[model samples]
Target: MHQLNSLEKRAAIALALVFSTRMLGLFMLLPVFALYGEQLVGFSPLWIGLAIGAYGLTQAILQIPFGWLSDKIGRHKVMLLGLSLFVLGSVVAALAESVYMVTLGRVLQGAGAIAGAVLALAADLTREEQRPKVMAIIGASIGLSFAVAMVAGPLLARWAGLSGVFWFTAVLAVCAMLIVAFLVPKSVSKAPMAETLALPQSLAAMLKHGQLLRLDAGVLILHLMLTAMFVALPALLNQQHLAAERHWQVYLPVLLGSFLFMVPMMIIAMRRQQEKRYFLINVLLLVIAMLICWQATTLWGLVLALLVFFIGFNFLEASLPAMVSRVAPAGQRGSAMGIYSSSQFFGAFLGGLLGGAVAQQFGFVAIFAVLAGIGLVWLAIASTMQVPSRAQRLSLPVAVTTEQQAAALAAKLAALAGVQEVTILLADQRCYLKVSAQQFELAQAQSLVAVGNQ
Candidate 1:
């Protein structure tokens, strides 16, 4: 197995911290906002839910634009600008006296939209072969951050109230900025590739891809249920006589226990090559969890429901992105991911809106009932998704000085047995290929490229 070099390691750690800190700032608000938000002027279930999800709306809109801008100017500059907006938004929320002001602050925070830039920068800093590991590290950090935020949010709220939480978020944003400015290794300036950067022209084709669209909708619905659940979960806990500060006691155990169950399922699915099977099972698990939440009458009952929910949530969260990578057309992964991410953020926005509306009209428990229905719809759609074949992506450096040469090389590579897709970039001096895992012969491909170069 290949290993990341010292520089790759440093870049991975620093960027992971940056990603985690920003995510933590966002997630901390998820668990505590409902309970403490009531203290603000103009507080209502609708406004509180909107405030919670308001950042997602802007994040959905601007993530791609920020990514494209980073390609135009530079990654570091765009990241700094995004982090600055985040810090400013956090401060605004910290000082807000009304829920609407807090919502405005959240919107500003979303406007920062650094996720795409961060990924692009990571792509710049690592080798193609090592990129998956780097991304896994970053993804793991986001998950860890969420677990920590769930526990820490309530504790912080107990100590400093909601404003204090926002203040802490602002501090985190500053730390991320510092990481971007000083810690992350500088990347070589190059033209962004369709593999790593979103190309606007490719958007429509990705939208029309049935498998990609299904994955996109899956993420959207998953996040929608998540944000909507929080809209009422805190209040439900409070009603069950659990104090706000003590909510962490429940979150810590449930999260930990859920991982215990989730990891085994993940391993089994991978080992058996039964991802679609497990995927459907996890989706069904979510539905069951929501139904449990609807009927739970005691604290323990709700805890059990949450345990089930997280077990499914964590697995799906990790799996969906991987599926998107596998299902995406060769050379167009960037555009597919851009659309998928936007859908996720938009889902969060909708979750807040719809979750709040349902909770306001029908009460908190009703939100779960609605979510369960949505899960069924997703389950039905997902049932028809084709299992992604085992495919390996290989990036090979080729000596080609002209567009015609590059085109000739691409055509030759595409003719190789087991090659599923091929993309050649003349400026990058590389050919990107997706090939069958079992049938692709590295030696054969290398020999062909060598002969062509000679």
Candidate 2:
């Protein structure tokens, strides 16, 4: 935080708010979609699952493209386009009269792909030393959004229904657009071209990087579990004759109770320097919870299972990115994050669709069994992963503009003391370095920036 200027902090907070508002619109339907989805024309439980997770599908496909586009067109410009797409999709969803149309709307909704763009832009504006603080704010916003959705979605569904919720999201999209235009300042980095990355290489680069792939795998599993549960949760609640309006009573307690357990473990992992051990244990717990959920017959049993479930879910959700931020190549952080994010949305889509089809035909028990199986496999893989301490990012402006000069400067910066990784972009005139924060202070990094300029 000492590294971040006032503008950077404000932008980070504003971006988080915008991101959460949009994400909430997507998740608001998750808690109770099954109740209303069945009423629309041609509503099969599986189709209903698609409608709920549709946005994720499009988001998954487009995030890397959008991130790359931002590198070429500027993050703000790319973000505005994404936001407009969201507004358009929201309108389509709000107007949908059938399940098929709603699915179309969801795909359109995901076309926004603004989240990656916004994150990239935030990184562009702030110093690397401040990113964790910035990311922490965004992460908190996401957790809060999930908590708020659990409390608010059901109540809103009772009053306005899914169409109404989409309309509300459409309105929020408009609000986010205005904020992007006027409130967020335009960013222009002065770093010489070599460190900043191109958008087109995002996906390919992420695919090839083993360290980043681990994080991506983790994200995919997390959302796979999330969407799978959401697909069945409402229908299960309905079996108890709980209306959409009343589902929150169950959600509220489960979410809150889980956080009580989740927060302490997160603290212990970081504070006690037991991140790898705790992370692996968390995945194992997820597997156990899934098995418990499969066997739950009473609402109390379900509630207990959910507490265990979210403790695993939320902890992984919080910790995965921090791990990626630490281990990914410095020049490729934006691209790595782009891939990680895409996997999350993709998992949501696949999870929802698969969970629905499986649950609709085989039974809810089968769905949990499948999810548990996946969790166990993921846990095994994760236990074998290299758990590296987080590496910090440092950005500096460069005076050179030509491609050759950018490459030369990158080499020079790479040779500098304590720099572990380097990325330089001639076009963006930016250079990014991954350095040991424990070994290098903010003032030292800043001084290096000055030296690079000279």
Candidate 3:
């Protein structure tokens, strides 16, 4: 791997902080909000579920648009604006007395859909060789924030209350805004190009791609089950043996143990050549987790089942973006990732609403059964997929001082052996290439580009 420059490392850290702040705000609410929501006046169980999912609903609607807009506007500018919106939303939620008001705050919170923009910006800013590593760093930060939030959120909720949690989120948002404004280094934004996809076309094409659809469906269903299960699981645990106050003892161990399992799986998946087999086996693990959760009884049994669930969850959560990098047509990757993200949020929304109702009526067993059914359907779809082969994620590098030179270079690179796809923008001073590993000849290709530079 090529070493990252200082600027690239700084950008990665800054971006990770921004992502973590946004995620912490959203995740902190999940552990305790729905249950307490019911105690508040005028709050129905359905409404509490809606409140839980409201951010995801709006985020799903706008993620693509925001990504497209960031392409036109400066990414940093869009990012700062989005962070400000998040702060505003947090303040609104913090002061709200009614369920409707809280729902509105959640919607506003989702309006700050700059996470995609940030990732796109990072891709734009970093070297192709370094981008994956930077992406991994940002992803790790998100996972860390989530685990910490689950354990910490309840404590803060107890100490400062949920409203206080929102207030803290608002402050974090301000910190994000400041980082975007002052800490992040400048880079050239993407100029409009013929190959760059429009919002509508991007969304439509993404939906039609069968592989991406399967992955998107899996995420939506998985999260829906997750949100809905949490809605009822704690309360159920209260009935069986453990009190709500001691729930973290269960969550902490399960989450930590799953990480232990996840590390080795990741090493094997990354190093081994059988991407298809690994992918399928991971999906099967989800099926097993669903079954375990379906039949869980003792407090320790619930923890064990969750351990299995996280094994599946962590594996899928990390792998989906890598899949997106492979499956999305090179030029439209930004918008494709945006659509993928929106689907994740929408899953959260649907899970909270539908999962709650199912559990309320038929009990938690039915909830797990429903999740298992969804996973089984996904596994069938996944099994049919021809997982993209392990190979270099193709991106072309070029240095040029003129449009004429860039056009000539682009043509020469496209004509080279192994080059399957090429996208060039003379205005942006960049090239993106997709070449198959079976056919790739990097040394010959490098010599060709070197001639263009001279």
How many backbone overlaps does candidate 1 show? 0
Summing lDDT over every window of 10 consecutive residues in candidate 1, give the lowest-scoring window.
Answer: 189-198
lDDT by residue (65-140, candidate 1, tens digit) is 9999999898999999999999999999999999999999999999999999899999998887788899899999
* Cα error, candidate 3, residue 132 (Å): 1.7
Stretches of candidate 2 exceeding 4 Å from the true structure = 1-4, 188-203, 397-419, 422-431, 441-454
Ranking by lDDT: 1, 2, 3
Give the range of the ten consecutive residues with the poorest summed lDDT in model 2: 190-199
Q: How far in Å is the alpha carbon of 307 misplaced in model 3?
A: 0.6
Clashing pairs counted in every model = 0, 19, 1
* Clashing residue pairs found in predicted model 3: 224-351
Q: 278, model 3: CA deviation in Å?
A: 2.7
RMSD, one per candidate, in order: 1.9, 3.1, 3.6
Per-residue lDDT, model 3, residue 97, is 85
> Which parts of model 3 are misplaced by more than 4 Å?
188-202, 394-415, 423-431, 436-439, 446-454
